[model samples]
Target: MSHSIAPATISSPKDLIAYKVDNAEPVEFTSSKGYEERRIHSEIYKRHPHIHAVVHSHSEAVVPYAISVAPLRACYHMAGFLGADGAAVFDIAKHRDPAQGADMLVRNEQTGAALAKTFDNSNRVTLMRGHGFTVVADSIEVAVMWAIYTQKNAAIQTTAATLQSTYGGTGSDMPLSYLSSEESSVAREMTKRTVERPWQLWVREVESCGLYVNTA
Candidate 1:
């Protein structure tokens, strides 16, 4: 989806930008990038019926791992949506074009379609090589946590890698031994059972902080 410009300063409902998506092609709103946003968002929605929301954010912590060989592992249960296996990085230049113009941005529908297809039902997160990351979820709340978890996970992974290096460790290292196939399956199943618990907890926290504006 097209992210809000200067979203952190958004204090009122009027500060947000909303768009009506359709099955047809997307038109550019302010500039050429607007068409790119329209097609990508609409195409993703069409492809994944379960996905009600998408988040595109840049994480400084995740930038290195995205551009480098380091992979995003499923190390944290809080970000269980990353799946038990691990994460994948979508590189437009590598995957789409090796010689010509394969910019990191999702500037076309084909690129957007390719990126959207990268995520199956098992995983909802992907690192855009050289750019940033995108998080897909059933709702905005879940998507928000997914984004946070992904950034935190990247930070933790980097720390773990550094510590291992400090300890004279090398090759296929992580904070802890990654989850086995069996363990990963069980972890995902447990997340399905406990999905709403964290949402409720977050609601209480937001209300307590007086940041819970009833937009609905």
Candidate 2:
């Protein structure tokens, strides 16, 4: 399916840059490979107009988990972002080329389409091994929230694993009952507000950093 970039309603590239800088991470939109990054971002943004931004990153823990033979299952309630059972893992192994590096596209439009197919009618997050994680939402805030929280969940699971050997806790197990009704209600409300705000703060952030430019 053809996907278009959604117009900025609240946030701007500046805002996203600032958020990344503050978090000590490089902004994907401003990197040398920004074009491909933007393409992926735009595709998701167009398909989900209600969302403000789509963020992807290579987190330390997630990177190892992605390359592992075993899938990273949601082991705690805080990882509800992965969805009730956990999200699907996309194998980008074939996309990796020693000459081209790990940036090879394992699957093109077809891959993206198939990867997204699993999330149909659901708010599931996906793990693109050797690539990163993709979180789709109705707004930038929600996207950012998921990006941050998902990393946290991974860290928690890792820590739990270390503790499990000695303490003997459940392994990579996330019970749906762990998701409280109140948290779910709040998530819905937050999503609504994020869609309304767009990337207002993100825009200001980019401007303040003196990185605002009309690349188009």
Best by lDDT: 1
Q: Given candidate 1, what's the lDDT at residue 82?
A: 67
The residue ranges of model 1 lying beyond 4 angstroms of the native Cα positions read 1-4, 23-38, 94-103, 171-176, 189-216
User: Which 10 successive residues of model 2 have the least lDDT summed?
Assistant: 1-10
TM-score of 2: 0.56
- Across 92-183, the per-residue lDDT of candidate 2 in tens digits comes to 55433445445545333434444545346665577777767777765556777667667887787667666665576555573223344455
Question: What lDDT does candidate 2 reach at residue 89?
Answer: 70
Name the lDDT of candidate 1: 0.68
lDDT of 1 by residue, 48-162 (tens): 8788878887789888877887667767666556655667788887455544365566755567788888776656888887888888877787777778778998888788778
Global lDDT scores for all candidate models: 0.68, 0.54
Per-model root-mean-square deviation over C-alphas: 4.3, 9.3
